[model samples]
Target: MTRLCFLKCLLDSHAPINLPHNVEILVGRSKITKIKDQSCSRQQLSLKANCDDCIVEVKQIGINPSGLDGFSLKQNCLYKVGHESRIEILLNNYIHLIEFQPPPDNFSPIKRNKRKIEDEEITVKKKKCNKTPDKDSVLSIKEAMEDVWESIDEGELYIYTSKGVKSSKKIAAFDMDGTLIKTKSGKVHPVDTNDWQLAFPVVPTKLKEQLENGYKVVILSNQAPIGKGRVRIEDFKKKIENLVAKINIPIQVYIATGKGFYRKPTPGMWQTLIEKKNDGLSVDMDSCFYCGDAAGRVANWAPGKKKDHSMADKLLAENLRLTFYTPEQFFLGHSIANVPMAKPEFIPTEVKTEPFNDNLISDDKEILVLVGYPGSGKSFLAKQIEKKSSYKYVTVCRDTLGSWQKCAAEATRLLQQGKSVIVDSTNPDIESRSRWTSLAKDMKVVCRCAKMATTKAHAQHNNKFRELMRINHLPVNDIVFNTYKNKYKEPTTNEGFKDVIEVKFNPSFDDEKSERLYKMYLLEK
Candidate 1:
């Protein structure tokens, strides 16, 4: 979180300040420190350092100027390092100066690089923990700061191990937030330590039992909010430490800060752990099981519990071919029924083809309008028409185009060259469909509406599956899908569509990954 503005000026000449005026320079201390801006003003350059042992003074450059050497500034003027500053220093061999410019009047204050006191505070705690601790049991301050040896993904993923017997083949993995513990305030995510409480009174007992049963407990959780740069990494670290202390057992923890193969249901973390951290012991996949809260289930809230957030945990188990259980099932000994979702229409493979027949339109010049929800496979179907059909149609999707109007313009140009165009967008309303039909009519070509036979539940399921799978596609959230649903108006022949064909959901994926994603679309809400 630290945003350091390093101002370094090498002694190239004796008179450095004589070079340029209005020269911008960064001023940073040799040692890391936090300077809280109390005024909260873009124009105000006043700053206060949190360290009581440090003092700011204008001195000779060679005296370390406290790491401010290159700044082109004036003497005896109040200044701030990151926001605004101007300083001048004299040295025996060269003159060093540094200047920090204030932001523009309209600039946002939120853009300021904010740093938390967590690192400094944590370093102090680590120093205390390092003293007189066992070399193998407790990590040295340097080792604790190092990245996990098994992690290949981006972002800072800290690994902490407890002092306990290691297991080569058996590992019991559990999720953190909702599975092991929850906020005492009943909030989804807690802002502070005091807000948390154990998910159940028996959590510690259950973990101890697992340890006694020769299972090395490991925590695999997704903490995506950390990647947003708001939540301090030290906060997450402190939480993990507190959880381990509460459990009072040897365990390992891994938190995926963002979406990636390491995130749940991808098996990247699992693969990395068993391959690199297991000390050459082969993992018994049959005996090892994963527990998480996102097992697809009917809602547990209010009159009818809302459906579980997702089926990511269950799917992760499926991907790994391991046993899967909900927190309630594993901890509370409850049998939560697996909620049925839409069945996937077809199996997906490494190479995906259009799941349904898309040759309904002839190779003759025509304007084909597509209508569906965000995750209703409109884009997939459109790509199929271009890939599998004889038309070799020019497909235009709103996702890639700047606007639908731009899509129409492209279609107009392509059709002028005697090319058939497929408008592969969610043409939800009659007015939207008319934009294409009007173009086709003006060109004396037939317009057809290929309404996808996809339901709301199916679309939502598909969207969630896409997100969970981390597919290389634009993410479609509930808001985006809902907005399309609200604006949808069934197309009619009167709207200029010469024919309307209901394209069935018959996607075929050549790979298991693609097939799993398609099944998500088929899952009944």
Candidate 2:
């Protein structure tokens, strides 16, 4: 049987302390990290967790200090710690997060090898006398980073490069998040700025080798949190500096904080480098290479690993016309796997062979109900219908009109005036489609269902593209997609429609740049 972690203490720069349910475990200074800080006690806090309920029975035992989520802990009293509790030991600002995790299988873990944890922590190094925090470290880092960072594209993109980092023709570009480092706590996202470690032990060695080979080692990464305000720019700057400092190599870095040209697969960052920052020298795409983890590999691409987050990294190399390598293939010398890649649903480059059929409406007295995903270009198609029909059909959208009842009323009002009506909305279910079809039946006009054949992948691509390109685009979450998929019933003549017209997703862009971006991989590979 697998031993499940009932309650686990996640410490920075330390091995996770896995505690079984109902069993008490002590957490403190050297037990977590070797950092000798006098503000922490040898036994700071004692915790007993119940994984099923996701609650911890914790007690402060040490006088040095221990607090839950910045709240004062009363000594000698048991506190019911919630799943979100963070136990701080005041140990040089290092936080010890205590989380309760339920067992994966049916059987709840009754006990664990508690003795092993104690044995492991016992081999700690000798502690120093009353060690204090280093204020100079912050000052030194700020000094080193002064005048090194600059932003463009209205702060969507940030470039951080020191004068010491020399430019070269043979580039060694890499993705930072999964390629060079990963969250130390093994969480999908870093809990704090300090919560990252090298992805592989030999990361530094590999980077050093790149520099030795006369390649300009450059790090390019998309950090959306920076733009979303989840992560402060100053904090991320410190993280980048810390990472480069650890490697102790002359390396430049580009960070795409927001979605746009600078974001990978667009080649904007690479273009900017060659155009502005490459010391008036052109880069050699033939010899240069890029490395990232998002190679469009599926789940179990590696043993016990999930699929890659996106195809941005691999697509970036393709856009730059450079050779690409997964971090595994580059650092570990692993051969490339023959996994099938996820391709874009539409080819924007393919010239429009056949003219678009504008005869969507059979008559002026008609109701055309559109049904598809939100980003499936429902509104765009509705506008085209209104134009092709020469203003004969008035578009009724739930998004603008506020409710389906209002949409039906407006459609009824338009139909009564002898004008055609186009219902533009994600009418995913039969009930939603029935609203318009039922109205058409009462009015004695033909009700046709125009079904958009846009896949989930394609819809997501269009959604992302709009979000990045349009300034006033509303955000569409995955929950919306899930809701549509769960309730969607394919529209047929069974729903009282005169005809179900199948509409293929053919994108109409305002410019060539947009046309190119739409052709690229935007979905998570």
Candidate 3:
């Protein structure tokens, strides 16, 4: 029997594959293994074994470069592989040692054992042959890299294509990690490459129904671990491919790989689908829908259930103005109801009509020192006070000056010129506030502290909102907020301030659109 073996094809070694002499046996991504490597072509190589010579002629037809015994084959050319050789695919991305395991006892070609050959061939044929994927798949994963996927926004967003996914007027979008599949390891995050299974038994049937009903299936996922260095990019990508292959249906995938515009609760990916990936077809908003596990349900909303991870998915659907549902509601027969999440304490619409300051407005020259968390709206309030002619002041912001010393220098200059200065920085403690208060004494102006009424939770909510909105500011990390909270001391008249003003948080939106988003839940918990 003219037999060959692929050694080291997988973590678990593959068995020898028996070949029919003189017949061109097809070897490809689908034929080789269930795990599809996009770098490896579907029709990667063709092999014809010579029973007499114990050699195989391999034709390099695929776009990916192939190595035969360390010799690179010319495009569309044939290279003769000896009894024992090594083939490197895609520059050693995968290496397989090929061995010629001829019939036992060095039997001659003419006297090949028919029964043994038949048995071995049957086993290898079963291993090698699987039904090819549907031809209607939309993706072109043949070449090493093709138009099947595109990474934009500096790899923050990654959009993928499949063989048969057709853009229709309607979209049936779903989240992947929790809604479609869960880690078989029973962990919140996947333990490794193999740690996954369909989230529920009915997911496939429900999704297939969507496909049959002319709706495009899409996986809109947030895989921040790729950028966070928690998971290898290649491994996660292979997992995605495996999930798609298991579904066995054409669908598109949108991955937000970072904490940026494409992340959920932001309309970046949805807008991209409409503006770019939709094949020039306008989407029917009324027919479109989204389903996810992060539906903002509170803890114990169901038996043994924890609080939903975040309201981001529900907020995403809200921003898109599409029908939203939990995976249970969409796939299982769970009743659809309003997704309940505790609204953030501060929404622009609910801002109180109370004055920003507890005291009356004055044109008196004074040093206005603000104290709070990093995103406590102090700088914004300072700018607002600067805009008023009666409260005109040169804002001495530490953020712009880059240091407290620079802020002191600028404030000294402003005060020397008889201009009142509003120092906008997180003066969280007595020590932090004393510097500005001391400066006020040096300037011989009455110092007043405006301790913002916004709580730490409210500031965190605002920080997340700004991140989702892509506002012109760097994201405030938890360390910054925690540092302020840890050091916070209540501002009082005892800190040498003439007045300790409690500034109520009365949010004002730039437009109706901003106001609408602010009303949506921003905090995950």
Candidate 4:
């Protein structure tokens, strides 16, 4: 008989079965007796209840006439029996013996064991490697001397030889602000990640490795914000702490703030670090490395030019024999090729003489012509002259005119007033200067060129300083230095000028001398 039919009969007879317990009722000769073991029966009942709740209907149950053995049910029915005899009876009813498995074992212990092995291997490998010099292992001044080495154009090998003991250790220093953290677009909003953090993934990782290898990892940065009152000292400290944490390295950080000599491109910061390290201590300056992202900083301390050995790098390399590295070399892991070579420009020795022509200036009208290379103190000098002199200063550039006609009109008005007019413009070439000179002739004013002959080096230096102060992007490299040096046309005897006052800037005097020669020009009657 099917279990469903037997259940239906039991239900019709009004026989009550415990909902918590599975009832095994013997349905023979129209008598029903229920057997129950409360605990086990309850569990079995729960399982069967859950199975019944699933979306499946019991189809058929068939018994094998020849003795209850393995049998099969149609669908959705599960065989449940407490004894072997009952199981045999279920088999006789053609119920399938579906196998049930116990719950799976947790695999955490196996995974943990594998991880332990890997960790042990790593530790063992580290142990086999060379021991990092202890923090107390102060290098002798002589030993330090062995660390300085030179790089060749086509790559070179550095051999550190001291007392027949040779070991190579490379240290690389980095600048923080403009080189690493770009503050140009303004302060990194407290939320936005720094671009350097995004670009150099290997810096932090490699820094940690270098630290572990007993290499001195240091940062020599110049922060002028404290003096400018833009950022508080504590806030700057916190920002640096945050940067260090992200890098996961214990880097010795030195900040030159508040107009101290330690600012970058000045060698003060590097000097401070070296002096501090070398104070009455047997420390080798040779193996130490100094690096910065600023080209000016690198160029300032670079051997030659100032021929100044007062630079910390020079003291270390020449005196202590230490090597230096730039960020370009460190991050790239190779010497940089195609660095801008300082090609000696052809600076004219002779100044073009200005013509002594009556047309150069009109009666009782004075003309002040401002002339200089880009950022060569021209604007500042002009401003100073405007403040001191009674001359009315006029800037003639994109601000006043879209065309030359407008410029001429404004010049005409200033000239007609018989006022001492100053034109603040970059009259780099003779053509541009001639246009203004022609306007002066038409106005019948006395024309004089106040050349702001600041050297290319000085102009570039001022520009870099300004960018740092303003936290602005570095300006594009002006090819004017090369252009003017090579193809610049000087004002000569042919071009009319009442007087040419040469502004001598000593940093590079060749340009001044070249401009001064123009004063001797005399106009034809």
RMSD for each of the candidates: 14.3, 17.2, 21.1, 34.8
Clashes of 3: 9
What does candidate 1's lDDT look like per residue over 175-259, in tens digits? 8878898898866668675567789899999989988887878888777666544466667677777788888877778777655
lDDT of 4 by residue, 413-502 (tens): 766765566666567678877887887787777677776656665555444444333322223245645665554555543567666666
TM of each candidate vs. truth: 0.63, 0.67, 0.66, 0.35
In model 3, residue pairs whose N, Cα or C atoms come closer than 3 Å (at least 3 residues apart or on different chains), thus clashing, are: 136-163, 136-164, 137-163, 137-164, 138-162, 138-163, 138-164, 139-162, 139-163
The better candidate by lDDT, 1 or 2, is: 2
Candidate maximizing TM-score: 2
Instruction: State residue 345's C-alpha deviation in candidate 1, in Å.
Output: 13
Span of ten consecutive residues with least summed lDDT in model 1 = 113-122
Q: Give lDDT per model, in order.
A: 0.59, 0.71, 0.69, 0.40
Q: How well is each residue in 1-525 modelled by candidate 3, as lDDT tens digits?
A: 435433334222244455567778665576454437786687677777776676677786777656543224444777676444555554333555455564334534342110110000111111332323232222223211211554554456666666666777789999987899999999888888789999988887888899999888888998876644456656766787788888877777888876656788777788787776777788999999999888767877777888877877887887688999888888787885644555534443455545555242346778888887877788778877877735458798776666788889998888788788888988888998899889888778889888888888788877877766656554477777888888888989998999888876667678877776676555544
Across residues 448-495, which tens digit of lDDT does each residue of candidate 2 receive? 989988877678778878765753334576878889999999888988
Question: Candidates 3 and 4: which is better by TM-score?
Answer: 3
Using TM-score as the measure, name the better of candidate 1 and candidate 3.
Answer: 3
Q: Whose lDDT is greatest here?
A: 2
Off by over 4 Å in 1: 1-152, 156-158, 296-311, 332-359, 387-392, 454-473, 505-525
| Per-residue error (Å), model 3, residue 509 | 6.7
